[model samples]
Target chain A: MKQLTVELGERSYPIYVGEGLLNDIAATLGKHRIGTKSPLLLVTDEQVAKHYLERVKGLLEAGGYKVATAVVASGEKSKSLSVLEDIITVALEAGLDRNSAVLALGGGVVGDLAGFVAASYMRGVRFVQIPTTILAHDSSVGGKVAVNHRLAKNVIGAFHQPEFVLYDIATLKSLPDREVRAGLSELVKEGFILDREFVEWCDANAEKLLALDSAALEHALYIGCGVKAKVVSEDEKEGGLRAILNLGHTIGHALEAVAGYGELLHGEAIAIGMVGAARLSAKLGNPASIASETERILRQFGLPVRIPRHLDTDAIMGAMMHDKKFTEGSMVFIIPKDIGEVEINRSVSSVWVREVVDSLKEGE
Target chain B: MKQLTVELGERSYPIYVGEGLLNDIAATLGKHRIGTKSPLLLVTDEQVAKHYLERVKGLLEAGGYKVATAVVASGEKSKSLSVLEDIITVALEAGLDRNSAVLALGGGVVGDLAGFVAASYMRGVRFVQIPTTILAHDSSVGGKVAVNHRLAKNVIGAFHQPEFVLYDIATLKSLPDREVRAGLSELVKEGFILDREFVEWCDANAEKLLALDSAALEHALYIGCGVKAKVVSEDEKEGGLRAILNLGHTIGHALEAVAGYGELLHGEAIAIGMVGAARLSAKLGNPASIASETERILRQFGLPVRIPRHLDTDAIMGAMMHDKKFTEGSMVFIIPKDIGEVEINRSVSSVWVREVVDSLKEGE
Candidate 1:
């Protein structure tokens, strides 16, 4: 097992990524247990409920825990207020106290929503993440969890880290092609902003990854989670260095709003958003070669390199305006300075953004 | 103008209980601003919207900051996830970005709901509380914000401090009598747990307070907020000293759950809970005189000294099984050793509690 620490000071936690982590939870939680509460509330989305929920439940139960399950419907919609209420209610009914733990046992959505609930329930409770998908490699490591509200995605949530994250790559065997591809975006983002070798690794291993080869997937998950763990550790709450994790997310979130969430999985939107950022980087004359190569690698991975057909510049721009990166009226974009290097670029023009988005809408 | 500091090291924030804070928001947001984004989405319940919502809107707008409004139907229900969704959607539709601030402009309900939204939006954004009710005097000072979930109250939320709290005492005139009495419980709590003299002062002045006399009301709000400010500053996230703040909340929360939230205000439930805690403390030989004095004080102030007639002790006990304070099936109570000193008691027996609650029920 490889351990990566998210350095959030006293609020910091560790992310364990490797094969067979699900079984090692007892040992993982042993170090973090404050001995105040026992038993854990396992929070999973409906999709995850089928494959690994019972397995995790069994693990905790066999360890002498009175495990209670709070199964939320898996999707962006599950992050809403009513769902949160239901989850909290389940935990409470199950006799969860402040010392009791909440184990988030799904992908990004489950980790995020459940973590937020734990964060505020009784003014905060301990939580762990047993993430199942590749996309969760990033979400599980970062402490950000929330659901969409009327105005934006992740519009309501919190920045509370978990005590530990058990990222068992074996859990990804059931992941669909699209979901796997979606997870790659965060890896791609980690590489783009923090590490260059990981980007090159992705470029060379795209085919191996597309085939879902165990070795390639493991390597990707490790490196992806590694980069994420490094950045999040440095700046847990996106104070500064943490913002780098949001490389493609500024535009990616806008695309989600314009296209409607679930129209394109978050990774798909971010993949395309990265493309837009790459083009913007080129337009701004920062690192044309790196931008081109990055776009080339994403296209090979079967991730969308362009915005969807129906989404136009106006709607995308409108979404961008709502992003926290938006300053006055301009939105901040992360653009690659070199193949493995990225920089936060805040000077892109709206006219240029519209042009690129419109071009991408017309299928690249 | 009164400036209260909640001194929880990194999580420390100032509570500016004054009018015209909305006018100088820049000064308030001076240090925490990560970027130049100044536009904000003001979230308020209906009750506050009619009074000072536009005034705050005008202030921010006049400060050259673009402002958007997200209003939910007022009351406790507004803190529910459903209402958060509506507000978040409005923020999304209005183009709220990560740097954009969330202004919670109402009572504890709106502050908690909106603060939770602000805590999670874009992994987190800045939020300001412009409290318009007496209850907010307590809620706004702490970083705690949440919505009710099933099985418990405040089952979903976060410990995210607002960028600033603009507590215009002038706004409390519109508050109802019930809310005022309900909020007084907090002040009474501070005295019972941390300052016995403060509690005596409250018992002496509660009548002037009920009349909303300016001096009495101001003093009450100040001392109440001051006690919270001192405790929160020491333990922002309830790791230790912060638990004292919840002296009455644990049993109060159970009462709220069993009594049905709408049946009793938070302060009222806390009122009843405080009485129960005092009884427990007295039985444990911590302070027998204190318990009787507390009951006398609450009764004299027109607060309930007994559990609701329609409530069930078993159910309340069952509900508290979910309080974050419970560890290993043990309920922890923050009970007073004397009039001015509080201790976190973890070894309280359930049998004793049941008997006390049983006896209290019989008397009622």
Candidate 2:
């Protein structure tokens, strides 16, 4: 097992990465002092529930904790206010209290939805994230939990840190091939933001990660989450340094919004957005190779690097205007200076952004 | 104008209590550096909208702010997830951005609903409180914002503080007689939690406060907000010291929920809850005069000190079980030790709470 702590003073918590950690979730929760007295709500999507719900519940119950399960539909659509209300209703009916923790036992969608539930339930409670997909390696580490409104993705959310994140690599063995590749996009995104060596390592071990090899998966997650943990510790609320983490998110979120959130996975949209950011970086006089390298590496991992031609460019640009990143009069973008470094450019021209959006759609 | 600050470290903000501050809403917002670049959403209830909406909007627009207004229905029912969603939709349509400040322009309901909107919009944004009712003196200063679930009041919430709280004493002139009395319930609650002198002063000048004398209103609010500011500063998330701030909330919330949040105004329900807490305190061997004195003071202000007989006791008790306070198979209550101090009693017996509930419903 490998462990790293997000050093947030009193709000600090740990991330645990290893193989077969699910077997000892009870012991891990106990070690973290997540009490058994209050009823625990385990929120997972239907897809994840099919594989691990009953087993995880039995483990918690064996540890003498009362558990309530809420299985939401397995998709982006589940990240809505109506679904959040349904989960809250279940929590009220289950008699969970302020002391109780809401546990997320699925991928990014489950983690985001359940984390918001914990953040808002009784004005915030303890939360635990057990990420089952590679995409969750990034989402579960940071405290940014939210539900998407119809107009934008993750526009309704909060900075709610979890008590601990328990990532059992054994669970990733169950992910579908497309989902695995999509998840790797975010894992590599951490390297693009801050670490050159990690990016090289991800490039070298792409096959092993795609195959879900236990050793490679654990090491990759440890590095990926370490980058996330470090960035978040310094800028928990995105005051300054945190905006760098949104390197590809500005365009990526707009793509998700324009695609109606169901057409493309969050990681896929971001992969294309990273390419766009690199292209924009070159337009700002950085090396053109930055764009090519980002695209090549994403392609190596079987991730999409181009926006679907059918999606309208105008609609995507409109969505960007509604993003949290679009503040003041100009677009705030995370433009890559090189393969391993990025800068937060607050005045990136909307005309330049529109051209990049148009270019990405033209290819492939 | 009398001002006090809720000293929450980096999140600290000022609370301004004055006669006509609402007329200068633009200056106050600009003073707080709530910028004019992004659009602002002014959330008011229908009742408050009829009086001050146009004037406040004109002031903001005249000062160069693009303001969008959302007028929810008046009363407790407005504090629901649906209303929160509706406001968010309005914010989206109004082109609100991350830097936009959500200005809560009514009483507690609007503050809570709008504040939650700001807190959850794009994972938190800038918020400003422009309170138009006396009850808001308690809710606005504490940074405790929430919406009610069908099952319980404030079961869904966040601790999102504002940039500043702008309370206009002039607005209170329009409050109905019953609302004035109800709002006083919370104002005096600040005293019961910490200040005996203030309680005595409130008792002595009840007529002035009831008659909307601006001088008495400013003094009372300054002191009331001061007590709340001190308590919240010491414990922002109710870790230990802050629970005492819930002096009567355990029963108060339950009564509000049982009455469907419509029958009893928040302060009125809390008034009865405070009386019940005093009775429970007496049962726990405190002075009997504590209960009588509490009831006498609340009655002096024209507030109800008894639970309505029509509401079912079992339903109220059941609601208490679902409250954030109830834990470890015991009722967690804030019981008065005397007229000016309270303690969080975590092991209070359910039987004793039942007896007090039964007793309170017995009288007029």
Candidate 3:
């Protein structure tokens, strides 16, 4: 097992990465002092619940904790206010209290929804993140929990850190090939943001990561969560430095919005957006190879690096206008300067962004 | 104007209490460095908008802000997830960004609903409080923003502080007689918590306050907000000492829940809850005068010190079981030691609480 802590002072918590850690989930929660007397609500998706819900519940129950389960539909649509309300109903029914902890036991969607439930439940309670998908490596750690609006993605949210994140890689063995590749897009994004060596390592071990090799998966996730923890620790509220983590998110979120969320996975959309940002980087006089390299590495992992031709460019641009990054009449882009480092450019032109979106639709 | 700060270090903000402060709302927003370039959303209910929304919007526009207005139906019902979604839809349609500020322009209901919209927009945005009712002096200052679930009041909420609290006593002139008395229930609640002299002063000046004397209104609100500011500054997240502020809130919230929120104004519910707490204190070996004095003071202000006989006691007790205060099989009550002093008793028996509830239905 490998562990890293997101150092957020009193809000700080650890990320545990390993295979078969679910068997000892009870001990990890106890170590973190997660609510034993107050009832715990374990929120997961229908997909995840079918696989591990009963085992995890039994483990927690045997550890002397009373637990209730809320199973949401398994998709992006589950990240809505209505669904959040349904989960809160379960929480209220379960008799959860101020000291009660909410345990999220699925991928990014479950993690984001459950975390927001915890953040807003009685003005915030303890939260535990148990990420089952690779893409959750990004969303689960930063405390940026939210639900998407019809007009935009993650438009309604909060910065509520978890008590701890328990990553059991044995769960990832159940993910399909497409989901695995999509998840890798964000894993490699960690390297693209601050670690050139990690990016190279991801490129070298792409095949192994795709095959769910335990050793490679553990190492990459530890480093990915480390980068997220480091950036978030320094800028928890995204006043300045934290914007770098949104490197591909500005364009990526717009794509998700235009595609109506369910059409493309969050990681696939970000992969395309990362490429667009790299291309924009080159348009602003950075190395052209950065764009080519971002595209190459993403494609190597079987991820889509191009926007689907059928999606209208104008609709995508319209969605960007509503993004958190679009402030003061200018687009904000996290442009890659090189393989490992990025810069937060607050004045990227819409015309330039439009051209990049148009270009991503072309053949290669 | 009398001003004081809720000293939350980086999240600290000022609370300004006076008459007709709404006319200079833009200048005060500018002083606080709230967004000018970013669009602002002014949220009010139908009742408040009829009087102040147009004027506040005009003032903001005259000061160079792009303002959008959302007027919810005027009542406790506005504090629901469905209504919150409606406001977010309005926020989206208005193109509100991360830098934009949400200005709540009514009493506690509008403040809570709008403040929550700000707290959740883009994982949180800047928020400003423009309180137009006497009861708002308590709700607006503490940063306890929320939308109620069908099951409980404030069960879904967050602790998102504002840029500043702009209290205009001039607006209180338009309130109905019952509302004025109800608002006073909370104003004197501050006195009941930590200030014997202030409680005595409120008892003496009740007629002046109810008659809308500007000097009495301003003085009372300033001191009331001061007590709240002092408590919140010490414990921002209610770790320990802050629970004292829940002096009557546990029962108050349950009463609101049982009454379906709209039947009883928040202050009225809290007034009854306060009397019940004092009675509970006496049962737990405190002076009997504490209960009698509390009921007398609340009666002088024309507030209800007894629960309506029509409401079921079982229903109210059930609601308390679902409150944030009820944890680990024990009822948490903030009991009075004297007319102006209280203690947080976490292990109060539900049997005692039931007897007090039963007792409250009988006499004045």
Best-performing candidate as measured by DockQ:
3
Kindly list the interface RMSD, in angstroms, of each predicted candidate in the order they appear: 2.7, 0.9, 0.8
TM-score of each: 0.89, 0.98, 0.98
Off by over 4 Å in 2: A362-364, B362-364
Estimate, for each residue in A96-136, the C-alpha lDDT of model 2 and write its tens digit.
Answer: 88888999999999999999999999999889999999999
Regions of model 3 farther than 4 Å from truth: A362-364, B362-364
Sort by TM-score, top down from the best: 3, 2, 1
Between the candidate structures 1 and 3, which one is better when assessed by lDDT?
Answer: 3
Per-residue CA lDDT of model 3 for A113-146, tens digit only, reads: 9999999999999899999999999999989999
lDDT score for residue A44 of model 1: 89
lDDT of 1 by residue, A266-302 (tens): 8888888787777788888776776677778887778
lDDT score of residue A253 within candidate 1: 88
Total clashing pairs for each candidate: 31, 0, 0
Model 3 RMSD in angstroms:
1.3
How many clashes does the backbone of model 2 have? Answer: 0
Fnat per model, in the order shown: 0.80, 0.86, 0.89
